[model samples]
Target chain A: EAGVAQSPRYKIIEKRQSVAFWCNPISGHATLYWYQQILGQGPKLLIQFQNNGVVDDSQLPKDRFSAERLKGVDSTLKIQPAKLEDSAVYLCASVTSPAADTQYFGPGTRLTVL
Target chain B: DQQVKQNSPSLSVQEGRISILNCDYTNSMFDYFLWYKKYPAEGPTFLISISSIKDKNEDGRFTVFLNKSAKHLSLHIVPSQPGDSAVYFCAARADDYKLSFGAGTTVTVRA
Candidate 1:
């Protein structure tokens, strides 16, 4: 079976610019997630969606970051007025069920803000 | 306050030897633990997982041991191969569906 898919494997933008990342979860998956991984650190959960509804986004930066999964199959994460500290790999993952423990991850979009 | 921690930044082991990675967690609510392996440019792939009720789980060459009393867990790769070299991350999950991850440990299997 195909795994989670993400667009624009890499991205570069200047500080204060805006950037967006896309994710397509595995077929029939019910849960999707977005995470940020800074250098030398593990992925940090940014947001989570169960179907078209958000399950958790407490860690998301409301002032600068936003995400949506309109149809429950694909999702997008956006960062406006990007900061230098936002230069990190944005990862997308999905699971077959909310109770399932394993999460399949995508290659991730490596964003570099200069 | 980091809930999960992988204290060793990296580890090196010879091929045919054993590679052990350790992780600790401060949260008692975490009932499920998992280990993921990641290459340089790709995302992490699930390796093995052990529930809190079980002290050990093994699959092929990889094994995971959990100690609920100490709030510690470990991953063991026997007869380490070059292909096993990668960053290893330990994650803990509760019923809330949120996963807390460690900083990760880089393992280098030498031939």
Candidate 2:
């Protein structure tokens, strides 16, 4: 079975610019998640989706950050007017179901905002 | 507020020795505890986990100990190998389906 896949291993953008990241989760996986990991920090949950519907997104920055899991197989996370503080590695993860204990993670997209 | 915390920023251990990483949680409601090992440029992988009802769980060379009363847990790696050198993250999950993570501890196994 294939693990979670993410696009654009690395990205660089200027402050106030917009950036987007994509994620394709493992087959048969019913839950997907997006996380942000700042340097020297662990991954922090940004949003979660279960079968095309959002399960939780309380930590997401509604003013500038948004994500969607249309069709429930692939997902995308976008940040508009990115700020310097947004420079971090964005990770995508998945689990077979919401009740599963183990989560498979993707390589992640390292975003650097200038 | 960060619910999980790994106070040690880093640890250096000689090969064939034991490596112990500690984590503390502020929330007592977490149902499961897990540890993840991450390499540079790669995402984290599950190492070992312990449920809230269990005090200890072991797999191969890794063992996880949970102390519910103190809201603390630990991971012990015996006979550490070079491949074991990586950042270790302690995470907790509740019924809300959210995994709260700590600021990982980097462990370097020396030969």
Candidate 3:
């Protein structure tokens, strides 16, 4: 019963630079989500994946942000030409199902864009 | 559009006292509500939750009350302790599977 795992606990990058974050959901979890948490603000959903397919990504910045859950176990979120406004903690969470999803969150990657 | 709102930015309560956090939502479609607590660096952990059909749900020292008509909900912590000091966030989920979160309220329990 391992929890959700995320890589690169912290990251520092310059505006316009490209960066990527990784996530590993809990075993047997069917739903994976990526969220952006700005300082002093709650997490905002960026994308969600049910297995290897995307369930929702309406809030994602299509021009620069992208994510993929290739094997349905691990996922990655990328931001190219990152903006200063993109400096925030990126969190990954997983759930077993839509009905009983309690959402186990990872430690998150804190990205600082200068 | 900021569907969920946590008015109080922060609260400080003496140990052994009660700590209450409030949240309001504008969407009626949201049927499930949850409360999560987060420390400085760690991820948020689930605290308690109450469905729309239920007015109140309690677990140990934590309790959640939901008001569907007013689109408001609250979390109450009794006998607050230092360990209970953290940022509390209210989240609402609809049948569509999206969770809308509040801005978060920081609670400080001085022991």
Candidate 4:
């Protein structure tokens, strides 16, 4: 079985530029998550989706960041007018049962903003 | 407010020895704890997990111990191997399945 897939393994943009990251979770996985991992820091949960419905996104920056999981299989995270602080690896993960902590992650998209 | 914390920034262990990584969390609401391994420029992979109900969960060379009373948990790698070298992250989950992570601890397994 293949693991979670993420597009554009790396991306570089200016501070004011916009960028989008895509993710495709594993088969039969109902839960999808997006995490931001800054340098020397652990991955922080940005948003989570249970199938097509959103489960949580309290820590998400609603003004600059947005994510959607249409039909609940694939997800896309977009950042508008990116900031220097937004330069981090965006990781996508999925799990069959969301109640526990068994998340399988993709290779992640490293975003570099100058 | 950082809920989970890994005080040690790095750890160095000789091969065939034990490697213990510690974590402390402040949120008592977190009912599940997990450990993840991450390589440079790569996303973190799930290493092992333990529920609040159990104090210890072991799988092969990896073992995770949870202390709900102290809000502390730990991951122990027995007879550490160079292949196990990576940044280890400790995470906690609340009732809503939202995971709170701590700063990672980079582990170096010396051959």
Candidate 5:
């Protein structure tokens, strides 16, 4: 019954530097997601993976952000040439399946780009 | 261009009183709505959910009401407790698997 796990609960990087966040979803979960949450706003979906395959990434900024899930169990989100606007919390979540609506979230990596 | 919006940035209610949080969505295709509660430094946790077909769903002291015609939804917590203080996010899902979320409302339950 362990929940989603994320690494480096907090991160700091300079503008134009690269940063990466990691996520390990609940065991047996079939769907994983990455989200960005700016201050005062809710988490915004960045990308979704359905068992090592992308389900949706329309909102992802391909020019700077990318994510991948290997073996459908763990995921990593990367931001290259980070901008000041990228100073926000990067959250990782997972759902049991496409039929399930309940999403379990991790503590999130708070990225501060200076 | 935000599809879901929670207008209230924060709310304060006395313990044992009622706390009501409102949310509005612009999309007509959204059929499933959910509420999540989050504490500082922690990710959001699923609180309650209501499908479009139903007007109200209740779990213990928490209730969610959805108005399809107005594209509005609300969460109500009765006899609010100090532990209930947290940010609450409203989210909606359309035909697709993605969910649209609103800027959350922070609720403070004063003892």
Candidate 6:
């Protein structure tokens, strides 16, 4: 089976600029997720979508970050007014369902904010 | 605070030797634990998993042991191979299906 797919394997932006990352999950998967991985740290959950509906986004910084899944197949994560601290890899993952344990991950978009 | 932690940042072992990586979790509510392997420039791939009810699960040359009372778990790779060199992440899952991950352990298998 084809794995999750993401765009712009790498990105660079200046502080105060906006950036967006895209993700296309595995076909037939019902759950999608966005995560942020800073250097030396593991992936941290940013938001979760269950068939285009948000299931969890408590850890997301609403003031700067937002994410959406359309048609339950593709997703986009956006960061406005990017800061230096926003320099990290944005990873997208998917699972067969919300209750499924094994998650498939994409190559990720490495965002560098200068 | 991170609920899951891999205290050892890195480990080096000779090929054909045993490699053991450890992880500790702070939450008792976590009912499932998983291990993921990652290479440079690539996303993590699922390696193995164990449920709360089981104390040990083994697959081929890999084995995972969970100690509920100690809130600790470990992954053992026997006869490590050069291809096994990668970052290993330990993750815990709650009933909500959200996962908490560790910083990861970088294992280097030397020839």
True contacts kept of 2: 0.87
**Which candidate has the highest lDDT of all?**
6
Residue by residue across B29-76, what tens digits does model 5's lDDT show? 999999999999999999999999999999999999999999999999
Question: Per-residue CA lDDT of candidate 6, range A4-108, in tens?
Answer: 999989999999999999999999998999999999999999999999999999999999999988788999999998999999999999999978869999999
The runs of at least 3 residues in candidate 2 whose Cα sits more than 4 Å from the true structure, single-residue gaps closed, are none
Candidates arranged by DockQ, highest first: 6, 2, 1, 5, 3, 4
The sequence of per-residue lDDT tens digits that candidate 5 reaches over residues A35-104 is 9999988899999999999998999999999999878889999999899999999999999886687899
DockQ of 6: 0.90
Task: Give the Cα-based TM-score of candidate 6 against the true structure.
Answer: 0.99
TM-score of 3: 0.98
lDDT at A102, model 5: 81
Q: Give all candidates' CA lDDT scores.
A: 0.95, 0.95, 0.94, 0.93, 0.94, 0.96
Indicate whether candidate 3 or candidate 4 has the larger TM-score: 3
Candidate 4 displacement at residue A34 in angstroms:
0.7
For model 3 the local lDDT of residue B53 reads 90
Candidate 4 - CAPRI tier? medium
Q: Candidate 3 at B93: error in angstroms?
A: 1.0
DockQ of each: 0.87, 0.88, 0.81, 0.77, 0.84, 0.90
Model 1 stretches with alpha carbons more than 4 Å out:
none
User: After superposing candidate 3, which stretches have Cα over 4 Å from the reference?
Assistant: none
Q: For candidate 4, lDDT tens digit of each residue in B1-111? A: 999999999999999999999999999899989999998867788899999999999999999999888899999999899999999999998887778899999999999
* Model 4 spans with C-alpha error above 4 angstroms: none
- In what order do the candidates fall by lDDT, top score first? 6, 2, 1, 5, 3, 4
Lowest lDDT 10-mer window, candidate 3 chain B? B92-101
Deviation from native of the Cα of residue B21 in model 4, angstroms: 0.3
Which residue pairs collide in model 2, if any? none
